[model samples]
Target: MHRLKVQGVPLILKSIVQLLHFGYHQAMSCLFPVAIFGTLALSNVVHLPFIYRYDAILLVLLGVQYFLYRSGLETRDEIKVICLFHLIGLALELYKVHMGSWSYPEPAYTKLFGVPLYSGFMYASVASFMCQVWRRLRMDMTGWPGLASAALLGGAIYLNFFTHHFIPDVRWWLTGLVFIVFRKTWIIYRVREATYRMPLTLSFIIVGFFIWLAENISTFFNAWKYPNQHQVWHLVSFSKISSWFLLAIISVIIVAQLKYVKARRVWGD
Candidate 1:
């Protein structure tokens, strides 16, 4: 374990050196989008059956990473620029959870409040991968593939409210608004590029439908109970469809990002 820790320090130091090599301006642009998505995943790792209280305990470690990365003799302005994005993102996440759109159990044994810390850091790394892929493929394709993500997020929220599974008393409008803006933003970019709209629309539909099968598998496995056990299904577990879709989109987005990078090197970027 001591050797592992000593070895890990060099790797951590290496990442810092590499990130510093990136310079400040480039890092700032990519950080926000990365953090937004990463926290989403950390939320999942917390609940993984593989480890109990994995999410809560990770916060301290994540905090250390966050500070270490933001440390050294850096400009306050630049630090604030990165910090503000996470603060807002984290705040928004808190709001989203409070609204009952999602949740994590008590933090007594963990550091995460539904969203885990390393998860945010993890997303930051993935975003770096995505940034490279986006450069080669162009924003439209990355954003294009992401239309499915936007819908899977939007549709699940819609279903939650419609089914009366999760009620939103206040700030519910924010959820819909967030989805609309994201969807419209993607469409605006596509239309601006004068790309074919039909194919893009079809892609989202296909991804959405793709989630149904995973829901069936999980239902059979008893991995979940729907509507917080308010509504249960015996034939096939349909309760987790939205959450599954959300998870699916994240998985695909990351894989697509990696594949885009691999294809570029093979063909010579």
Candidate 2:
């Protein structure tokens, strides 16, 4: 028994080391997101002269993006992906604010139809995270559906976000299609020589839950206000998790397609 206990020590140490490595990679992947949230929190407390808080935040985020790119933290292709997400997110923000779904409720030179320009960074950060984590984890997918099917699902998910206001919400139908589309899919990731596999849908749910938590933090920092949060800062509705979950699906599909394309190019070469 003493010899068996002694042998177990190496296994325990190995597990601890793997956990540390995982945490470190996750932190690195979250660099962009952490920067955005830090800016939001700091802008709330620190006021700069001759600049509105929102505008200042926007400038600071732009600087951060430049620094990240110049410092080689984000590659050129990743920057392009992030920019795409920024535009996509900005469009959604514009429509949602117009529909009274949410309000920025702050004055800024950078406000476009009541939505701050910095608002796009929040979405860009998600793409940034996806890119960073994918590279760090050496992630790949198996049993992926055809590109057309995947694109259709992602496009439908995005459109539903807008169309639901006018038409009956078909989010549940979309959600069902998500499961169906990814039924055979698995995400394979590596950590320090050990490999792991998780269902693609499960990864979406996990990422969505964390994003929901981040949303609560963002609202607490007065990043944006829902109808109920206008008076006082409160926890965001849990139902928002479903929205983030769908959004997560969109983000993943975009990143996955890019990776797939890159792989095809390499094979062709």
- Which of the numbered candidates is closest to the native, going by highest TM-score? 2
Q: Give the Cα RMSD of candidate 1.
A: 15.8
* lDDT score of residue 73 within candidate 2: 90
Q: Give me the runs in candidate 2 sitting further than 4 Å from their true place.
A: none
Report the lDDT tens digits of candidate 1 across residue range 1-269.
Answer: 99999989988986676556444434443453334334443544556565554443355435543553576322333234334334533554455555665344434344455653433332233333334323323344434435456456545543453445355532245334444544533421221223323233333334344445533443343323334532554554444444433333343344444545567789999
List TM-scores for all candidates, in order: 0.31, 0.98
Model 1 stretches with alpha carbons more than 4 Å out:
1-52, 55-89, 106-115, 118-132, 136-198, 205-269
Total backbone collisions for each predicted model: 2, 0
Backbone clashes in candidate 2 total 0
* Predictions in order: lDDT: 0.42, 0.94
